[model samples]
Target: VYNISKEDGANICQWEYWGGNGQKFILEPVKEIEGDVNADGALSVIDVILLQKWLLAVPDAELTDWKAADLCEDNIINVFDLHLLKRMLLEQ
Candidate 1:
């Protein structure tokens, strides 16, 4: 599953795609669009907060793609990442 669907959690599980000819295509694992942590189809301050909460374990917070959250590309998500994300938001 390369492209995630709009339905919440729709792309976050195994799926079976049925073809018109009665063919079945099975895909494993969840597919998350990069930078769409909340999966709302856009990067926003909410995403930043979600990452923050996830790092702090503030309950019910989550990050679907650590790769996307690692803004600095340092293989870690920390306050530094938050700063980078903020900077990116500002630049955009």
Candidate 2:
């Protein structure tokens, strides 16, 4: 659990539990790695395989970050993206 200071530069005398948006702090944006469909913080054959399974409509197939798999920068997720993912893996 994390509690934020009530005001900037104020001496925090006491801490309290998070009070939803009223006390929540802005979180740093997470940088998503391209081709990392599983959001494992790294790109590898596992990501490629996950994207492939998602495209093939395999049961229980899920993409943690579909946008990361969009290597082509196109709105569609198809064989082209899969090819690009594989190429990226080969390059790495």
Candidate 3:
């Protein structure tokens, strides 16, 4: 299990890997934002805006991994993230 954060520079937030036991790995939920695309601690239009900018070539910090934005697990954050965000907004 993993927790995603939206605060700037927040890394990993929390991650629990399988321990080889029957117990499921659990991580503390991120109360600030759920499904923050850019992990900036809030699920707002800003997250979608940032993702658009990043897709358009805004360079991320050297240590930032692109996987953080790959919301659909498609190995890229493009139209997939956009669609996902749209769906989320509709649900909200």
Rank order (by TM-score, best first): 2, 1, 3
| Candidate 1 per-residue lDDT over residues 5-88, each given as its tens digit | 443454444547644322334658766545556767678888888888988889878776667788777887888888887787
- Give the TM-score of each candidate: 0.59, 0.72, 0.48
Candidate 3 off by > 4 Å: 1-34, 59-68
Q: Where does candidate 1 have its weakest 10-residue lDDT segment?
A: 18-27
Q: Which pairs clash in model 2?
A: none
State the local distance difference test value for candidate 2. 0.83
Superposed model 1: Cα runs more than 4 Å off? 1-34
- Candidate 2 per-residue lDDT, tens place, 27-87, comes to 6798878889999999999998888889899999999898998888978899999999999
Best by lDDT: 2
Model 3 residue pairs with clashes:
6-39, 6-40, 6-41, 7-40, 7-41
Give per-residue CA lDDT, model 3, range 1-92, as digits (tens): 12334445544423355553323434587553444755666567766666677667777622133455566877766778767876775687
Highest TM-score model number: 2
lDDT of each: 0.70, 0.83, 0.58
Error of 1 at 83 (Å): 0.4
TM-score of 2: 0.72
Instruction: Summing lDDT over every window of 10 consecutive residues in candidate 2, give the lowest-scoring window.
Output: 1-10
User: Which model, 1 or 3, shows the larger TM-score?
Assistant: 1
Better of 2 and 3 by lDDT: 2
